[model samples]
Target chain A: MLRKMRRRITIRIDMTPMVDVIILLLIFFFMTSTFREAEAIDVQLPHAYAGVRIPKTGVYHILISEDGKIYADNEPMQSREEFIQAIVSSRATNPNLIFDVKADQDVEYGVMLTVMEDLRRAGIVRFNLSIFKEAGAW
Target chain B: MAGANVGGGEGRSRTGRRRISIHIDMTPMVDVIILLLIFFFMTSQFKEPHGIEITLPKTDVPVKIPESNTVTLRVDENNEVYFNEEPVEEISKIREYLIARQTENPNLVTILDVHPSAKYKTMVDVLDEFKIAADETGVTKFSLAMKREETAPEGGGG
Candidate 1:
């Protein structure tokens, strides 16, 4: 009697389903992910009903805290001269640059006015005062 | 785990009876995907903040401001609010006054004369009131001005 011995078998996996699921997940993430501009400091904005949506591009941010500290693009500056220099340099690159002044509600009006004066002396004419919109104020 | 052994060596011929089966565990993959989904969801900011435009008055250039169609709202250093030369007893009165003024002149412009020493909160509150009034009465234009040099009245009305 002759006996037949079975050869060792190799198993294979079809990766089509796994690849399909992974690709679907990749597409979902790509669709849902949002790329937002970086904010250096947080501010407690005043609420108003006449607030408008400011343009996202071509804007410079000047943040003022309650204690009269000034920050340009999140970097604290020593004097108005520093602010003027920064604005001049930034304005050279983008002529249409508009300043977005965000001042805390508790800050004295004089501090804000002085900042605005410095910006104006730097030749920045167009700017927005950042404010949060009050709900149901339309 | 229940479907792990469904297709284990069932299609083998009699000669190849000893067969091996392959299984891919998807629990770890699903866990990773869910973690990534949560991470993306947590870091994303969906809404943009709002703002109101303010043009600073030029020190060198003097422009004539028309007084005919303008309503002046002043906030003194003591935080007393005056609407169109009249003292406002309550903040809500600003809305009512603006509505009445809007009926008389549709193209009215509001000028805010804020004192330098005035509290920023008071100015903001007044601005908020103006905004509410504008929204209710359909007045679109407004401006901020520095209060002219004048002496405060005796015994300050707070």
Candidate 2:
């Protein structure tokens, strides 16, 4: 009993497994993660169940606020002419740029369509409309 | 293990030959790695962006569809949905109407004509329902009609 009392119990935990897992996760995130640019305007995107995953790279954002304000790639435009000019300049640098439009749900359909008409006039045939995912049966 | 022993003289083996045990202090490295991991986890957008693909016509010319073969849906400013000039009680009924109409006429084309003052969400909701109906009937022909005269910008001025 004296010998048993003299010996002290020591507790040790091996952190190798945890460190290994963390390193693996770090590498995974490093490979797959892409940083998103800060948005100039806030928009409450509409929810739809038919939304498909859009490509993250080579995307130019077109944001439309609730008050009919338009932002091209976080740059506020004074008018539709300025918006078109911005698109034209951006297209010069990146020919493969795909516009991804994010309009607030409260925005008027007229404003949105007028923007689309301008895009059409600018020779842009295809674009993506950003939306949130709604929970539903796929 | 705390520090690395680079040819330390204090370590000696039983054979009288000099020996050393090298160890690396992993605490600092681990701390940095953990910090990076947390930063990435917080900054990355967890949800992938979802969107709908749209293709517009190249010219200002409009394509005409037969009146009898077309079903025009009108959504007013108050979120009121009208099906072929008839008011619909609920938006959900659109799916049923489309499915029934498509079954009746295989060549039927849908046209969405939303009022300028209508909310954008109403159009999206209607499009979603149209997609559902299209999925059921395997027909995807649809058109978006908008008024361009009153709001048209004639001058160079914005």
Candidate 3:
């Protein structure tokens, strides 16, 4: 009875270390994560099983939100003239420069096509899309 | 018995009294740092700033582009400009933004994804901004984000 009483009645697994590590990891991902806003547009993106990460060191980016918003690298531009001029300058140095487009899924298809047509008129022939891979975990 | 001492000793070891050293190879850390730095450097993404009041056309295209460092321009059905994804109200602002990106990386390029119903004129106007800025600030070279059209029915079939 005495021995039984002396035996440890409770056991504990120290999760402090694990919790500390998890905190550190979370902080790391948050700090270093280039959290490009997936919600830049209000539209629910049409989900697909395919997406590749394109490194954007040298590409032009365009965004169209669900509300029909237009942005060039996050700057709100007012006229077609300004938009075209920007593209032309980008192309002047690297004829192979590409455009990365992000638009709300609800944006009119006709509008997107029209923009491409305008590019051809300005003598630009190359561009690509910038998309996010499925959210697996940060 | 040994594990308890080992665990308890962890506190004492921190005081550096016993001279026990924990060796963590920094090679992997360096590799990860370099890789992440390269990724952020290469992706060169900008913030979204402006928006217009137009709706987007729905599509069933199943292909999605991968995430990368890219310049994005958004267009609405009414033909407006949004930088990065935000709505920009001034040409000068757009000019400065382009110049800044070019300044950061000489090889920096751009991408344009517009709503299909967006106005053709709006697209032209957006391109014009880049061209003018590049000319004034010396930003050269750009790319389009969309595929070429098989026909030119734009501008009311011109």
Candidate 4:
């Protein structure tokens, strides 16, 4: 008499390569990602082809809304004098402070010149005008 | 010599010092790494911090620029563009004019004179054009004109 025999085979796959790739991607994202901060005012920046990538720190923001209201570092200023005073006082502490003007697209051009003149009076000769990158403008 | 060989060459003693096969499960570690990766990937914004630079002179002293090497672009309230005080019907004329003028004269000084009521977007658009022209000519000389009391009268063409 003969007895029938049954055998089982197990297959294993190597997950090392997949896990290694995931870890590499994880590190890349962790290093390059920056959390977005909540903005005090919503500004619709205009598109421009010529601009440089501004740094994250050591800069001050002068925001102008579409309604022609100005804000210094997110604080609404009643007049241009207050804005100048704020910049002058801030410059007293940090001489290397860079002024960044973030104005809405609908804002008047005259308002920008006024802000720039005020910045010049506050001893700020060089400043940045923030703009969105136009894809095909270059 | 015979006593030295008694236990030194035993195969059982070598087997006793063999390294143990310790298998560590990597499923949990990989799961955590994938979770963190997803979180970062979702929250990351690909926005480049872009801005246009403007540098004003420290002193208010006005420097004289020759008319032969000067180009003034003036924008009005209705986003109408003017090239060298001449109203341009087609905006592309300004770009072509800038490129041609800048190529002809490297020392060309471009002035921006914008009316107060004009939209800010128009100024940036014109500045972008100037930049493109400058890149081709390898020279960039521009200034923001002081505030004008009133808008320049519109003309048909020059």
Candidate 5:
């Protein structure tokens, strides 16, 4: 008489390929993407007849929304403390980064004043707000 | 949560004679990920910095500013923003603004002016505000007009 034999189970996967692919993708994005030195929020910038394109340089872009919300490179900060830390980090990497601010047309004047004050306190030397052409146009 | 359950299956498994370990030490990985998340969360920059509302003006003439170098400020129809001609922000942004100005070396300074049909007082503020940024940065050479007709000088527009 012969005894019955049981089937064996074997499952092995090489995770190296997947991890390698993920790391490769990360590297690709790191090299080909534009890392915003500054945070920019949702604010419809007035379209210019000629919104000229400048060369690639250390420039910071700031966006202010209609509700007067501020963003740095898409990251939202609640207070000056958060803003300062973000600026300090950007300055560390790109000291020459120029602060380019874009605010909604309907934003309050006093609110802008406070934002400027905060940038000054944080040590941003240069910056400008963007505007579109005349009314009834883009 | 989904991944935790999948990885947890091997966590409590008893070791065989050979003791083949298949667990991914998620504790350390999770710690590292959390730390990185915190670092980025703490370091990210905010654009608004502060909540300020100012209506911007629309200019029939669109200015060409390159992606880099220039700092643009807008003035809306509301005269609340420094009488509508100046920038709402202070002098800090001026240095960079002027630096961009000099770098571009444009025949004219591209100042965008948008004026909506708001109240007269608001319009005045929008037009007259935010000059300090330019003044502080020492960028005086500029132009003040909408657009030189598409017809252009001697018909540049085709």
Candidate 6:
């Protein structure tokens, strides 16, 4: 008597091309995406017509809250003296440091001036005040 | 016997084929990637937060600001703006004054002296007015000055 024969079927899927495309897309997004810098405090900047772009490097961000609270690099300072000390220490390492003062629009001008005075005392002459661009006309 | 023979023949025919091609649907993946691309494209900002164009005072080294053809503006504690020690009733007056001044001098330099007790917004508004007026007439020299701190009064214990 003759024995019955059996057959086997095989299936294959190539994931190489699909994976290559996915990786390319991921890389594109990763390279192009830019994350907003985290701030220690929030400030509503005043609007001005003479707004100009500032360089990103060597900038020391100082945030002034609406209630006149001072923040340096996401850390709250107890007083202007403390803020100045921090700036002096940072400036010792980086002489080309540029202070970027971010003050709330509603904040009293006296508080902002005090901060400026402190920065001056710290030997930081080169500083920029952050302002929003005016909407309609220059 | 015939049914058994037919079943054996069918089984032998089934073993002839191998290597079946598998297809994975990538439409869903493509859709998701496109959505993400749109999201990022919309959210990305090219312009950095801008800074006011006026220069600040230096602590150690003081630069000589030209007094010739200069206009001095002051903002008081009550947000009142003064042009050359005279109170300005409207912002347009400032623009008009600068334009008229620019026509005569052409090299007009505007100096802003802001009081410490004034609101920050008031200072910005004055600056904005200055900027508009200066730009309209092609005047570039501008400086921001801080009010001198008050000296302590000589007195006995209260």
lDDT top scorer: 4
**Per-residue alpha-carbon lDDT of model 2 for B45-148, expressed as tens digits?**
76789887777666555565568888888898888999998999988889999999998998887888788899999998888888778888887777777573
Candidate 5 C-alpha error for residue A35, in Å? 13
lDDT by residue for model 6 (B1-158), tens: 35534545676745754547777776677677767766666666555778764344443444454567678788888889999999999855787888788788987667777787888888778877777776687776666665455321111000
Give stretches of model 6 more than 4 Å off: A1-32, A135-137, B1-21, B27-46, B57-70, B89-93, B106-109, B132-145, B148-158
lDDT-based ranking, best first? 4, 2, 6, 1, 3, 5
Better of 4 and 6 by lDDT: 4
Task: Please provide, for model 5 over B1-158, each residue's C-alpha lDDT reduced to its tens digit, 9 standing for 90 to 100.
Answer: 24534444465533422555877744454455555545554554333122112222222334454434333334444432321245556423434544556545533243433333323223223222323333334444332222223311110010
What TM-score applies to chain A of candidate 5? 0.58
- Give each model's whole-structure lDDT: 0.72, 0.81, 0.53, 0.82, 0.46, 0.73
Sort by TM-score, top down from the best = 2, 4, 1, 6, 3, 5
Give the winner by TM-score: 5 or 6.
6
Q: Report candidate 5's fraction of native contacts.
A: 0.00
| Rank list by DockQ | 2, 4, 1, 6, 3, 5
State the DockQ, from 0 to 1, for candidate 2. 0.69
> DockQ (C-alpha) of model 6?
0.35
Fraction of true contacts reproduced, model 6? 0.63
Winning model by DockQ? 2
- Model 1 per-residue lDDT tens digits across residues A38-109: 666667777676677877776788898888889898889899899889888988998888788888877888
Model 3 regions more than 4 Å off: A1-16, A23-32, A37-44, A49-51, A93-96, A130-138, B1-158
| Interface RMSD values for all candidates | 3.5, 1.7, 13.3, 2.0, 10.6, 3.7
DockQ of every candidate: 0.36, 0.69, 0.07, 0.64, 0.03, 0.35
Error of 4 at B119 (Å): 1.2
Which prediction has more favorable DockQ, 2 or 3?
A: 2
